[model samples]
Target: MEALDTPVLDNHLHLDPRYGRGIDAVDDFRRLGGTHLLVVNKPSWHLDVEASEGGDFRAVFEETITTVEEASEALPGRAWPVLGVHPGLVSRLVDERDFSPAEARDLMQAGLDVAAEYVRAGDALALKSGRPHYDVPDAVWEASNDVMRHAFSLGAELDCAVQLHTEASDDLTAVAAWAEDAGMPRKKVVKHYAGGRLAGPTPSVMSEKDRLETAVERGEPFLMETDFVDDADRPGAVLGPKTVPRRVRWMLDEGWEDAVETAHVETPKDVYGIDTRATLSR
Candidate 1:
């Protein structure tokens, strides 16, 4: 595929230090024509049983901010941070780490509070939080949902966008309803790692064209993402960071430039309040 002439941002990706390949991954993505990325803090980097019990995430939050800063200095204009506690981690803390419901809630809330501070300080572009896997225990699922609701509330209060990492088969209508209850505008909700199966009023960063077409029919805004995990063991577990840009190049080759531009350019700027041209020129 030909290189894209227009800038493209991968809306969700993990480039934390624990990954070990963070910098290399960012470089690879940039070399492949990706212009910008929203670097999310991995759950393991923050949530722990002890921290959960105490409702403290000061250390983890500081590390996450440092990671974002390092990535920005390395790639400049191409890296931004998305902060929040992951629902999956909350479930893990309860189920595997033996954290109580109250402890888990405290941990989740603390993480959201810190995330709010980062967004308010203009250090983070959005909040990343959502429900865990579908097969988790009902109690654990509920706890995760509670944390997610809290995240939505915080995002609304801060006027920041939220990137949701939910189950593949989950109904987004329910999620959107939760966002509405939290006073978060549907437009500020983004379904991360979305494909062709789900549909809802909120925008999504998706990979499949069929899903993209379905979303467009509903007149909701959307973007595209590779969800690159940057894991050597899972090499391209979701898709390479370059996948979105390569797809854009192919779409351009097919004379679908307008549609491609809408997803890769227009929708991202509208939703995230980021200007790719402005970001890259900095």
Candidate 2:
């Protein structure tokens, strides 16, 4: 198949050479016309690192930045890092590590602080944090929201985006409220794995045909992502690395060229404040 004139961007993806295809996965995306990636850091435990303090997360963030750099080498400035403490880690801290809920929340907030430092230092483009996507105790739930609030505040201070990984919900008014309280703009907060237009933060719609069509028909600003975990054990768990480009190809084939530019170029640029054209050219 011929590549489209416009570039495709995958807003959320993970690349781990130790457990997955790593650079080869990135090459897969590239080969399929995906020119840009927002490479999110996996949970700390995924890297076999258990963090007690903020500094302990440095290794996790650094490894993610390294992956971004490596992906960029193959695709230039098209790849960027989004680092943060996964909300699920709170459960691990409390359950396995035997830390109290408050302590776990504080540690996750500190880790987000570290992620902000990376964004401040120009190593990453955004910060990521969200509440658990599953059932949990009330205390754990509250602590997770607290951690997410800290991330919103960090995003406010750094003037960068914050990608959320939360339960599937069409309504995000609570998230919007927190972002407002933290002085972060609603548009700057992205809802990863979104289905369609949300009431709160901008949706980063996953690459599913129905959702993509819905997002386009709505004519509201939204980003597109594959959420590719890149795990060999669960190959194409969420979606393959090539999904975004392939979907973009569908958009173009279906005569949704304007939607392509809006989703892959304009929306991401507005949220992350990056020059997509220049990055794609590089």
Candidate 3:
């Protein structure tokens, strides 16, 4: 992981401003000469995880969005934001928990309203890019489409990209359908953790890499990202941010660039689907 501090894109980053305002983390990244730090929103369960700290679930999304806006003001152009939605659509997850759609809509609307402030400034819409995980229902798949369609409409209106998360599952297909349904601009979608699969050895699933290549060949705006993290004391650390790029870099160097635009981008603009003109400027 020595190369980690080398200023990678650090896609799928969760910054709990509630944790050090990420000043130390940014310093650590910059110390390694890192270029960008895309601060993706974190799941409600992820806040203060190592310390059992979490903000109000209802406010987590809005708070994070506002935080990204502030980071943009602070960094001017370095803190790229990512609007990735993981944990299988917050509404679907909480619905099973007895939260009504009306309640969820309130949270979503509030979050989106706050999100719009930054999004209008040009943030990429980061989606989980996954199928159903952890017993997520099929309805969640439709739920994902609903989220993507709505997000795609907003992203397109804002001239941003819809960063969808997908694996071997048909998640990408769902997104494509959503885009078509919304008549959103289609490009190579950003594929996070290109070959990284957290599901653990499911031979039946399609690898993230293959799907990305497909997206690229199809003339989609499929970008590859290194969503690596350093979790020392965990064997999975080997697979986190360190290794994701090694393989990605190899293929990228070996003619993959023609297939799609690959970059180590981190900033509110890049994360939420903006053109990221500055972040990708090599």
Please give each candidate's TM-score: 0.87, 0.97, 0.59
How many clashes in each structure?
A: 0, 0, 32
Output the TM-score of candidate 2: 0.97
Error of 2 at 276 (Å): 0.9
Per residue, candidate 2 scores C-alpha lDDT tens digits across 45-150 of: 9999999899999999999999889998887347999999998998899999999999999999999999899999999999999999999999999999999999
- Number of the predicted model whose lDDT against the real structure is largest: 2
lDDT score at residue 150, model 2, on the 0-100 scale = 91
Relative to the unseen true structure, what is the C-alpha lDDT of residue 125 in candidate 1, on a scale of 0 to 100? 88
Which ten residues in a row are the worst by lDDT in model 3?
Answer: 198-207
What would the per-residue lDDT of candidate 1 be over residues 1-282, giving only the tens digit for each residue? 345578777778776456447677777776667777778776654324245432365566666678767766666356788887777776667777788866777778777887788799987889888887567767777778888888889888988889988888535888888888899887788888776345553455565556655545544456777777777677775777667666666666667667666776688777788877777753
Ranking by TM-score: 2, 1, 3
| C-alpha positional error of residue 21 in candidate 1 after TM-score superposition, expressed in Å | 1.7
What lDDT does each candidate get?
0.72, 0.90, 0.44
Q: Candidate 1's C-alpha lDDT?
A: 0.72
Top candidate, metric TM-score: 2
Error of 2 at 202 (Å): 0.8
Tens-place lDDT digits, model 3, residues 1-282 = 233322234445555556433444444444443445566666544553211112233255565666656644433236655553453444454565554444443344334444444556554344333334455545555554455455556655666555555544433444555565565544424444443221211111122456545544554223344343322333232233333345445446567654324343323233344444454334
Off by over 4 Å in 2: none
